[model samples]
Target: MTMLEGVTTRPGGRRPGATRTRVDILAAAQRSFAEHGYVLTTIRGVARAAGVDPALVLQFFGSKDGLFDAALRDDPPVRALVTLAGEGDPSDLGPRLAARYLELWEDPHTGPRMLAVVRAATAAPSASAMVTAFMTDEVMLPLARAIGADQAELRAALTGAYLFGVASARYVLGVAPLAALDREAAVTYVAPVVQHHLTGDLTPP
Candidate 1:
């Protein structure tokens, strides 16, 4: 099944006319999770940000885990990548993924949220686990299976490592050379390495 397949939206809490409140809570949660990660973000923090009672957050989300899970589903970058992955030839998945990944980073709408997720993943254990599981189960496994690659799981891990490393260096850390490279230049150089990880032989170098 797809990673986000069965995720039902949470109920709008006990209050009537609570849609705006729920929306505010969710937006606050997103920024909080992005800024502080799972470990540091709390119901009170979210409530403070949303200017709502902490009880309201609890009523809406049930628990911190519930809120985190719902937030992930709310803005799944994987769903977008999955659509791009399935397009064009399967053998070209690496380049396709690279292109799409770059496009996502370049996108103003999605980039901030993705950056938040990445930041949280690096700083918080739960956030890291969430990202790892999402990538392994929702993303890499599906893509590997789609192309019938040998050592599919390993390939997925490797692909993730490569992609994440590049993203961190270029976007987060702002490494000089990599950061300097334009989008086309970045993809041209990185896609082949990604392709090799996806479909190439696994002999040790």
Candidate 2:
């Protein structure tokens, strides 16, 4: 189960009579993201799986990069994660957000896949676009809202830099000192930054 999501959900697949002609291609890309990890997956393989003309996939998504971007929007962590945040106090949002974010990263199945995608995205245009799109659409939107801030878009992007950086260093790259620290240690240090981002600093006792 992802963060706050039930595991029973499955892709509805293409709508009937849709024949957008690119449906198969999209499905193929989805599987590729899961099986081969983003780095090893290829547009050619996706084309082959779809059993359509390889050029069709290219024409539809514009590039492997374009397909990757679409994938994030299509299948994202937002629904569940947001569900977890439902009806919660805005001021105390930091730890909940941090906990959910960390939970996703720590998940065994999702973690490896996510890690693979992140690694693959580092150099791949398609993968990079996918990563950027997910962060913008899912994580950033609610993060801005939880804080009751205007310019949610900007706040979201700023929060992205902080969160993604920590995820990469601690979970992905496994920085020595940070890796050694416990989750509580992380929550204590990390939550304050999230707190500031969501609810800006003000004079206090």
Candidate 3:
């Protein structure tokens, strides 16, 4: 018998078609979450966007929270931030990190996903906890430790707060001159503050 004749597909097997369908659903979910945030996005809406039955979406991800968790974990900009935290000279880490963080927000492809995560964190407790854990445990803590900073956790937290505040003001709230500033000028203003948070002394006078 030919090789193909001897092989039979088993029931419930993970075929290529099933994998493609899953991927399509995930892409739809990402877009939905990005456009609508966690509180507003729904399994049925994502299913409709993917052109699949709502049951299939539920089958793949179990629940709306599960899908949101997956989307957060799969986010490229977050991954990029984590990767950046480990690279380059500690002295210049501030500007590099600042530039990259801003670039992700500016890029049309990644901007929506980043905006979704931030907005969802503000709107939903579950999303907030997940994002807080990821940012602190995965990205900031390691970077602080890698730089041999004392009070690493506190340093990491401060750095995160500064960056988050900047992003929220400029992108989310569209506040004043900050929102209007060009990328380079914003970076120039932000880099030093980030540098101090990461490496400067924190002891009170």
TM-score of each model, paired residue for residue: 0.80, 0.73, 0.83
- Clash pairs for candidate 2: 65-126
Where in model 3 is the C-alpha error above 4 Å? 1-21
**Candidate 1 Cα outliers beyond 4 Å, as residue runs:** 1-14, 17-24, 35-40, 48-52, 59-66
Q: Give lDDT tens digits, candidate 2, residues 17-58.
A: 335556666766766776676776687777766666667678
Judge candidate 1 against the unseen true structure and give its global Cα lDDT, from 0 to 1.
Answer: 0.79
lDDT of 3 at 120: 89
Report model 3's TM-score to 2 decimal places: 0.83
Cα deviation of 85, candidate 2, in Å: 4.4
CA-lDDT, candidates in order: 0.79, 0.68, 0.82
The C-alpha RMSD of each candidate to the native structure, in angstroms, is 6.9, 6.5, 8.1
lDDT of 3 by residue, 93-153 (tens): 8999899889989998888888988998899898898888778877788888888889999
Error of 1 at 60 (Å): 5.1
